[model samples]
Target chain A: MPYTDNTFFLYYNKSVLTETDVASLDGILSKCSAGKQFAYPMADGWYSSAFYFGKGLGFEVTYNDHLAETSIDCDFDNATGEAVTQAMWSYVKDSRFKADANDSKIAAGFNDGSIVAAVTGIWNRTTIQNYLGENFAAAKLPTYTLYKGTADEEQTQLVSFAGYKLMGVNNYSKNKTDAMDFAEFYCSRENQIKHFESRGFVPTDVEARADERVQADVCAKAITEQLKHSKTQKSVPSTLWIPLEGLGNAMITGAQSGSFDLKTQLKACVAAIEKTTN
Target chain B: MGKKRERIKPNVFKRLIFAFKDGSYATRLSFLVMGFGQIARGQLAKGFSYFLFQVLFALYMIFFGGRYVGHLFSGNLGSRLSGERWNESLQIFEKVSGDNSFLILLYGVVSLVLFCVFLTVWAMNVFGSYENDARLERGQELSTFRADLRSLINEKFYIPLLLPPFLGLLVFTVMPLIFMVLIAFTNYDYAHMPPGKLFDWVGFKNFQAMFSLADGAGFALVFLRVLVWTFVWAFFATFTNYFLGLVIAMLIHKKGIKLKALWRTLFVVAIAVPQFVTLLLMQKILDGDGILNKILSTNILWLADQRYFSLLPRTMIILVNIWIGVPYTLLMCSGILLNVPTDYYEAARIDGASAPQIFFKITLPYMMHITAPYLITQFVGNINNFNVIWLLTGGGPVDNVYYGGGSQAQSTDLLVTWLYRLTTDQNPKYNVASVIGIVIFVISAALSLITFNRASATKSEDAFQ
Candidate 1:
């Protein structure tokens, strides 16, 4: 975490929209969902955390996000949470938003040019790069509005979970001194730069960041901007994953069906989350 | 007539006692300290190896194993806490409490097993020394170490042959099964996850919670619903496949049925393509945005809508199960149906019986008589069927009973899937899962045992003969 950054950023085609248009959640959803290709893995529980956190449910979602989750203090039934869900109700019925949770499915959507933009992380960089080539660009996740018209427009930024891949030397290793030396060398600026050259890894070392290649990288700029809005993931219980996904997707489905009352359904989702966490 | 001889087998304890008393001093010494008699008989290599094993066992008991055996019932399941104290000498806080209950339990079981193996080795030493002394007393030449090695391949061949596979099964399968059964009595839920927290034996609390209607989670309530659906699913899955498959089999294998190979091959293609693929493809075809909706000119949330309390989803899983299951039964029924003799039908016709009467009285009974065990297995298979419900609907269209606010349990969920969810869900309930597993085992085992007994009982009737 001190060196590395891995968080979900908004990636879109330069051909479809401008920097100004992609700044807000409403703009992206309204413009893309109507006719043009836009998609996100809403059904995926991992991605669903973004919406809940964006809605300002329970507590402030922190950087140590996984460890931060104790029990469900869900407020999806409350005014603010309902307000966000109500905003989401508008986009839920759009054909552009597939009832799919799989990241691979999203990748396929991008590859086929059916999806003009998506919300994902650095792991998907290569796939999108190969698909969209020069047209591919990335930015921080779009902000959402809690108030309709109280002020002109005060936007609440969408936050995503951030994590890091780290290396450590084992205490019991026979080659402990050597292992420590290698670990240090592995994380060195020169080697980190080498990694960036070969594997396109954004380096953690400050010296490596000053490199011209990193300075020119498009994905790196987007991630750097996104880091401001990102939270460190805590080691939370796995129990919340499904219910979170379910709550988000259920709202999406409810929006489409219009049969299940949104508030009642949101209440049930909250109740399920509460019961599970308890 | 030769009488079947029944040898009076000596009780194990009595045999040990007899071996002790009748044995020479060296044999007695070897019982206490292994290979003493073998050393006396000049089988020095064998003697040394046996002695080495004894020393290792003694060392193990003294240093590591004895502690674990002692801790098993000591009522001190260590807390998963690292207590700290200020150390004046080092001028820093030092950790004190390092005891972990989970590791202790694991090590204890392993030690118990090792302790049993040591006892078995001790018994073998006593028996071997006793035999060696007996041979000496009878004035027979002592077997050389080479001769002992030769006898392992010839007379004791089965020991080497069976030991490897037996040990593999005992370690992997039997140990894990015993561990699960032990887990049923513990309170190892998400709240008490190890090695972060400690959980201890709570006796029958987990069992009581399963059946108690007063509990908060309504696990008992939903469990009953899931169990009922499991049985209903199993019954329909098995019988529909059986009857429909039989009809298909009878039709394809029926006399004067033309293009028989063509019809059979068409059905066999379902078998050739893996069921999981077929089921997933079916999912895509049946879903609202799927090909079926495209062709049918109707948008139906076939897998995701529960309008009538899961009447739709429940019916959907059963019907799909029958479709996937029938081809297997059809192939089997065709094979066995051929073996049903033509004589019963011929004789029934001679008695002026109606076509339906002959078909029911002869063909049906005969088929059931032969396929009863298969039917039982299929029935049990359906009870634990995870794939059909999972792939098709994922036990979805989330029902009301699942949540606290009077929601539905996903109507198509079999007990296995529900049990799977209980364990794999964010707040896993392992103890409850274990209890459910035991219950499922009891149900399936009981059914299989009954059907098997019945099958064997009627085997002597010679109805077909």
Candidate 2:
């Protein structure tokens, strides 16, 4: 379930973040500096939810396709959630990383060479590649250890929302036989291999992934590694998206501004979710 | 010269009474069935056409229109559930399509409009029939169909010309507005999106909640704060551009100003470029690591950053709005200034008055007099200004200083912009948004009424005109 045809992975400029540093979130965060750093859009709800989605919380989501209803269960204010989140939050006070809500700001930071590495999806692959040239490399998002700088040594890995582009035959098609034939032909292992070779799409067909060229491709290899840890995201109703974002954003903004303590902010976020769901 | 055309208009109720009393047998028949009077008076072609409409309308009502009116009262349940029945012989299930609520509502509204049109045509037929019978009784020659057609170009031009546009506006514009305004009194929020769920009227609950500060949500608190900023923004946006633009226009219009065309074009060039691009570019330029930040070596969160530590974004957006607005004001004020008489300025200047004195006495009074109406509209426009705040900062760097009520609106949000966020954001609180819409409409409407009344109050002072 990696539609972007591939998963988001760690894309780093080889000059700054080496293979060792790229393996862990804290390792990379500890090494970076002003005008040369890592940027993860943690203030964004979609991306920041990863902190809660680690093996500790095990967030669950369900959707009623018939009724267009969506239900999300995330206990991000729990002890594990706070620990993981606070670990991500530790980077914000550092001026070099420039953590904020706007995703473009991070992309721009990378474009201007102020960002040496970023946690981003495949949409930015070409841009990052062009920027880094031979220095371009991608890896599955690093396994993070909670509070790397402090005494707490709780280990966790980043989890992400992953999706697939599914194709189906219409029951009422005029040429049902022909349509079935074409659908099969399009998604066949041979064609999937061809797609991976040309379009860089990670094929759904298992046999297509066995191809030598696909195995050698850096982008595909990184994606394969990343997808193993991703959640098969439900088609969530858009109705929950903005409020959830606002809730998360309010928490971050409150904590940053000293308006609300972390515990109070966490309690309010859950309360908000409960209010909306009811 | 533009007097009301009372002579052409048929009196709403009196015309009906007079027509029935004076009408001939043919005229009375035409009232029941269109074109009958004209046919009985030897106009066979037009009479058959009128009768055809009567037949078609009757058939439509029987076959289709009746169902729409019926469904309007029916449960209006979106869709009957689709089902599949297993067929053992074929080893497959047969599928059935579900009902659609959208279609029912659409057809219901359309039919209602068509019925209204039918009534209008019925009235027209009665009026025409009575007029013809009256003319015949007066010993006046009855005009043929061709004469009736010719008169449309001469006297009855407004009927044919205005009818289509008026109907178009009613169907597209007025209907949507009425639909949205009605939604303000309903619980059509995220949980009650139509088709899947039914929403019933909740009366003034949405408005009540918005106006009340009792709820911990603080919707009223946010509303007042955003509203205050909206007015403050409008005041600053309007006057800054208006006065500064006037000064710039006067400087360029001055006698000693050289290369006048070049200076005007330089300012006009900003406006010629599309605004979204400029606002977006401005957003990037003012960002923390942006060029401006790099040059100044100061980490100013121009967009308030993630926290509202700085009121920089609010001030920046207003400043950019001023920059974007000045050119338009310059163009408009230049035209107004050109019409101001040189004699007034000369008279003030010859009286031993300095440059500042002449401007204060003669220039300011004349320009303000001509531009007062313009100022009101400009103020309204600023009140509704959505682009600058939206595109530049998106009413952001979220802060506890502003009221949220589950919205992401920041310190910079205008009421209109905040309403936009409420409606279009992921979990749309459409009812609250609609209430906000009505509030904005009331504000605009009240201001417009006051302006129009003031204008009429001084109508006799037409010396300026």
Candidate 3:
């Protein structure tokens, strides 16, 4: 019953990308998911994608709490608890994934077929293509509740939801019923399969995860493995991206300079985040 | 009377020109010539070499130097190579466009013009030398270049001599200052980027926003509060060093003080170390778990605590700055103190003046008179004390009440530090930064001008005698 799910796999390369590169890539991915609307929420690196998707295709999108825009005046008192519950259910129903952008690492994984599919959050798909080469297939994110026993079972566990792009019904929509219907249809198993074959994400439908294509994709396989352990970033009421980002910069600089105490630095960062959010 | 006036009519300019036309072979050739002027003036090798150098220089400028000069103006030049795009709204990349090519072209043209002016000056010098040689050949007095130099020194030529450098200062310093002052009038915030976003001249909008009590953003009220703190910080920073330096100088100069050289060197060591190095070291030492904090387990968030944070860090920096600055003043005061006549002190003591009385009446008055100019400069230096605030607290423990765009600033930040952070920090507001810089300059200039006028007007009548 999940509307949509998009899985982004993070690939680790021992020799290629440094931790800083991974961090930078994380930034680019957040920006991508900013304005996107999808059937299922994605993991990290979805912001930039959402931004492009929403701006390019005019999708009604909601992003993760960390990367959310400051202008979204949704308050807890007036918040649609029903919508949040539905979104949570839809997100939990999707499989999580991981992928490395290192070519040699991907080649090794693909050769052994250890990875069913690789997840990548970078804007430049060309980089992923160059890294993965011709040996791998792509697929859409799988359903979150595939192994679901209860809502509590899903809630107890956390997933790598650092980057996510979600779909929402826009208030100004002319065809509300038709739009909802279209959303449900697009996220169905059959349509998910089509989406998976074309877009490099796991199929969002609950049943579509069993598709042969989903089973065969290298990035998708790795993502499913990570989905079991993925945890979404905690959402604060207000957006603290810019300030928190500044704290991150200060932390990195402090670390580089070896000046301030790291613990104090972290505390300063946390304080900054709390101040901005509250 | 008519003949006498006619005889004196060939003034300096006419005499030189006439001498050039009737001069010896070398004089005539050098005076009338351009490229080979040096050789005609008896500088055969220098003339040939300079001509060749000019040819090569011209060629180099035409082919390569011109482009380099143009690039200084064109901030876009690097952007072309790097393709660095400012990600405006997450996905949408907006290329930074307002490069102000006119500024670059103007810089380039000015540089070329300066080079040409240098050439013309060189040509005139050659003509002057040629005229001098002609005068010598005609058995008239040869006023040598050395004589000219001596006469220049005698005439207090520093007035005219410093003109070129003064003009340069006016162009670069004064003009930019005026531009920055103008920026303070506009609302050039983050929403209004230049070139693509033409920020109209909003007369006194920014200043009003910073000063008014009922502004919508409430940022102006915060700025006004910070401004008071800034002035307090400047006053303490300036005077603390002054008094400390004077005391140290007096102590060392005392007859009973031993190993004066050794004591002075110990303090001088602090001065020898660069401010950046010392401030950076201080930043490390004062960290939460840093050496200073580690010594005391009461773990004060020196940079984080809002209650006492502003005053504490500002006071700490001033004290630390005294350690660095006192020695310089001490050295200066020592020289001035020695120059103070023993007769003044003896007369004061004979007249039954106490030690404090002598210091207050005799020493203080003399020091103030002699050091008025230095004190003004010191005040100016404190106003623009960028390194101290920057390397120490970095204006941190930012309060919500006074928050600007960033998290690294607080209410304690001096104008210079705030301006610096604006320009160099993330979300660089260059226009605002420049405006703050000008504000600092105006305050310093006004203070210095008043002090200068007072110092000159109130000089002792018998001091010059």
Model 2 residue A226 lDDT?
A: 83
Put down candidate 1 lDDT per residue, B1-465, tens digits, no spaces.
122224785877886887787777888788778888788888798888889999998898889877766776775556556456876875544455566666776777777777777788877877887777777777788888899889889999999999999889878887677778877877777666665566777889878767765546445676677788889889999999899989888889877989998998798677777889988988888876578776987656677665554666678777887778888888998898898888877888798999789778888888887888888888888899899988998877664434332212355677788678778765677888888899999998899889878777876645653
lDDT of 1 by residue, A1-278 (tens): 13356677888888876888789866775557533556666656566567657755543222232233345455667877777666555445566555443567568767877677788887788888889888988888888666666663457788788776677765435665677677778887788888777766677777788889998998888887887777677644343455555555565455455654667666666665555422
Off by over 4 Å in 3: A1-278, B1-203, B351-353, B403-409, B461-465
- Between candidates 2 and 3, the one scoring higher on TM-score is 2
Between candidates 1 and 3, which one is better according to lDDT? 1
**Which lDDT tens digits does candidate 3 get at residues B269-358?**
886878789889887777643677758853344543444335555667777788778888888888888888899889987999999988
lDDT of 2 by residue, A1-278 (tens): 22235346678888787888888877787678876777776556667666666654644456564343455555767787677656655555555555653556656766778788788776677767777889888888887768666777766778776766656777656665577678778787787787666666777676677778878877878888888878657644343344345445544444445353556545545544433221
TM-score of each model, paired residue for residue: 0.75, 0.82, 0.49
Could you give the CAPRI-style class of model 3? incorrect
Where's the lowest-lDDT run of ten residues in candidate 2 chain B? B399-408
DockQ comparison, 2 vs 3, better candidate: 2
lDDT of 3 by residue, A1-278 (tens): 34334444444432333334333222222222212111111211232122112111111224443233233322211123222223332332222222112333334343443332334442223444555455323332222222235454321212334333445554235565566667667666687688666665565555787777787765666557655544343443232343333333333223323343334433443333333210
Q: Give the RMSD in angstroms, all C-alphas superposed, for model 2.
A: 5.2
